[model samples]
Target: MVDYKTWMKELDDNTKLTQLAIPGTHNSAACHTALPSVQCQGESVTEQLKHGVRFFDIRVGKQFLKEGDDAKDLQVIHGKFPVKIPFPRLLKDVLKEFYDFIKDNKSETVLVSIKQEGTDDWNNDKDEFGNCIWDRYVDKQKDLWYLKSDLPKLGDARGKLVLFRRFGVKDDEKKQKFGFDAASWKYNTTEDDRGRFVVQDFCEIQNKDDISKKVKYVKDLAEKAQKSNDDKLFVNFTSGSNFFDHDCWPQQVADAMDKGGVEKVFAKGCGIIVLDYIEAHNWKLAKALIDKNF
Candidate 1:
C-alpha cells in the first residue's frame, strides 16, 4: 500500500486528475459540530489529507466585513447551520492549513470544491463573496493554486491547490471558464454526462429503502466510469440526509453503506468518491478507493 499522504507521487505525471480515483468528503470541515444532521465527517480537513482524501467539498458562509487588505472572514457551513473546526472561523486560517499540508507534501494536490453556503437572503455580488474568494483567499496565495478551467496533469498540479469553484466569479471572468467549471451541477440527483463531471449526489434519502438505491447509484456510476472514464470527472457521493428523520441522517447513511459493503461499491476509475464519516470501518472506505488508483 502507498503512503496515504503522498499517494499522488506514485501516479505518472502524464495522468490527468480526472483519470484518477480520488477519495473525497461531502462536507470536509463539519467534524466539529454537535448536531446530528450537520456533522458529516469524523476527520478534519488536514487529517483527511493524511488519509488520502484529495477532493474536498467545502461550503463557506460569508460574514462581517473588514475594509483592509486582510482576507474576509468566511464561516464554514453545512446548509443553514454554522460549524466550528479546531481552527478559527477565518477562511484564511483554514486555507493556511491546506497550504501547510501541500508545502510539506509537495507531491500531492488538494482539490477544493468550494460552494457559497448560508441562509442569508442576499445574493453574492462581484465585490462581496466572489471577490473575497478570488481576490483575497485565492489570489493572495497565488503561487499555491491552479486556477485553470481545464484539467491538469498530475505533474503540473503537484503541490498545488486545484480549484473547483462551485460559486460564480467576478465580471471579467464571467464569459470564460474558471477553475474546474463546477458552477452548474445537477442538485440532489445528477446526470451521467455532465460534461466536466458525472455526479451522483442523491442526498434526499427519504427512507431506509432509498439507501440501497443510493448505493446502487454509486456502484452504477463507478462501473460506468471504469468502462469509459477518461476526460469526464465522476463524483460519486455516499452521503445523504432527511431533515425530518434521524434514521436518514448522514451518520445513518454512512453506517448503512459500511454495513452494505462500500468496498464493493467503489471500483477502478470511480473518479472522486465523496463520503461521510470517512474514518468509518477503520478507514477501509477511503483506503479501498485509494487502492484503485494504481
Candidate 2:
C-alpha cells in the first residue's frame, strides 16, 4: 500500500501546500447519516485517514438531547439530517482517531474544513448549553491544531490540524485567529483569479445531465491550475446530490468524474481534490488522486 496519509514526509519541507495533490473527503463524518443528500461518505473518519485522505469537510450543529430540554450538544449535521456522532463524541472518538494517527505519523498533517449547520444560529456566541462551540471545539484545542491563516510548508504543519474555517469567526479581536476562511474563495459563483487559491463550487447537480457539465467544469479548472503561473491552490469538488433523485448521490458523481476525464487531469498533477463516497468502488478514486503525487 502507498500509505498516502504520510506521503508528504517524502517531499521537501519547503514544498508549497498549494502544489501538493491532496486527497480530501467531502462530508467526511456523514457516513452514518441516512439522508440521501447528506450521506456523502461511506467510510468512518478513521478509515478515511488510514486510507490516505488528509482533508476533511465537517458540518456541525447544536442538537437538543430531548424535546424542550434546555440542554444541547453539538452534533454532526448535514442539512436536516444528523449523523450518529455528537460533538463531544466526535472530539473524543472521531477526532481522536486523527490525533492518534498524526502522533504516530509525525510528518503528516490534516486539513479540516468545518462549518456550522442546522437550525441553530451559529452566529450567536453561545448555544443553549451556555458553552461557546467555537471556544470549546476550536480555541481550547489550540495545541493540536495549526490555526495560522496563511498557507504553510509541509514541515511546519506536520502533526497538526490545519483548519479551513467555513463558518464566520466570532471575535473581532481574534482577527488573525487560526485557520483560513473558506469564504475566501468564491462560492457557487464564477471562477476568477483572486486570493491565494482557486476553487470552483459546482455542487448543484439536479439531474443526470448536469453530471457531465460539472465534471467538465472541474476538469477545465484543474487544467488551468496546472498551466497557471500564480501558484495558487486549486480545490475542486467532485461531489453532489439532488433531493429529487436519491440515486444521484455524491458517489455517482465521483464515479462519473472518474470515467469522464479526471484521470488525465490527475496524471499531469493537480491540486486538492475533494470527493464523496471515497470508500466506494474499493477506494479506487481516492487511490487515483493519491497516486498522482507519486
Candidate 3:
C-alpha cells in the first residue's frame, strides 16, 4: 500500500520548503473575491484552503483538439471556486495535464477538488471513543445529485499508471467521504432559480441509528453489485434507522444489493447515521465512490 501518510507529510514538508525556496509564494495572500451568491455557507475563503484543500484552476483555451474547432468559445468557467490540485508542480504535474485536457476540449470549467490524508478537512483519525466523522459528512449530502463536472485530470491518464501502481488505486471510502465536497452545489433552493447549488454544508452524516444488521446489510448489497456488473452500480437509500421501529431495516435493501455485487451503496433521506465507524472500517469504499463519480 502507498503510504499516503508519508506522501502528505512529504508534500506538506516540500510545499513549505518550496515556499522558502521561492521567497514570496507563501508571503503573498490570495486576494479575496466576492462571496458566492448561492446562499450556501461553507468553509470561508480561509477554510477552503485549510489543510487537504486541493483546488485546481483550469483555463480551457479555445480551439478544439479534434478535427475542427473555434477559438472564440474559449473562455474561463469564470466566477466560481477554482479546481483543487496538490501543490509542488513536479509531483502534482499530472493534474496539470488533466487541466489542459479540459481546456482543450472546451468543456465548461472543471473544478477538481482533491483531499489528501491527514488533513483537517477529512478526519482520518479517530478519537478515544472512535468515530467516522468523515463518513457522516458523505451520508449527509446523499440526497443531492451534485452538478458534477468531470475533468480529464481524474481520467486514466498515462501518469496515473505509475501513480496508482506506486500508490495503489485509491480505496472507496475516501471518495465517498469527500465526493460532495468536490462538487459545486447548484443554487436551486428558491422558487426563482433553476438547479444551482446554493448551499454548501461541510458536515458529516450523523447516522441516527446504532450499529446493527443494517450496516451489514448495506455491505452485502454492495458486494453483490460489485460482482455482477462491469459498469459500477451505485445506490443510495432514502430511509434511515428508526429508533422506535427495530424492524425499520433501514439498510436492508441496500445490503441485498451489495450481496449481489453492487459496486457502491449509500444511504439517503434525512436522519443521523454513524459516520465515525464508516470512516474507520470502510473509508476506502467511500473514497472510491466519490472519486469515481462525485
Candidate 3's TM-score reads 0.22
List TM-score per model, in order: 0.91, 0.88, 0.22
Tens-digit per-residue lDDT, 1-294, candidate 1 = 689878889889998887878889988888884455889988788888888889898888755343334324677788877676434355666688799999999999889988887745334564366666776678788799887888799899899999888876556564253477677666888444667778888888899999998888877887787787358888888889998898999999998888877678566676888889998867888888888887
lDDT of each: 0.79, 0.72, 0.24
Q: Worst 10-residue stretch by lDDT in candidate 1?
A: 63-72
Model 3, which residues run further than 4 Å from truth?
5-211, 235-294
CA deviation > 4 Å runs, candidate 2: 65-72, 85-92, 124-131, 184-187, 190-194, 267-269
As for model 2, its CA RMSD to the true structure in angstroms is: 3.2
Q: Rank the candidates by lDDT, best first.
A: 1, 2, 3
Better of 1 and 3 by TM-score: 1
Candidate 1 TM-score versus the reference: 0.91
Candidate 3, poorest ten consecutive residues by summed lDDT:
18-27
- RMSD per candidate (Å) reads 2.7, 3.2, 20.5
Query: Candidate 1, residue 144: CA error in Å?
Result: 0.5
Collision pairs in model 1: none
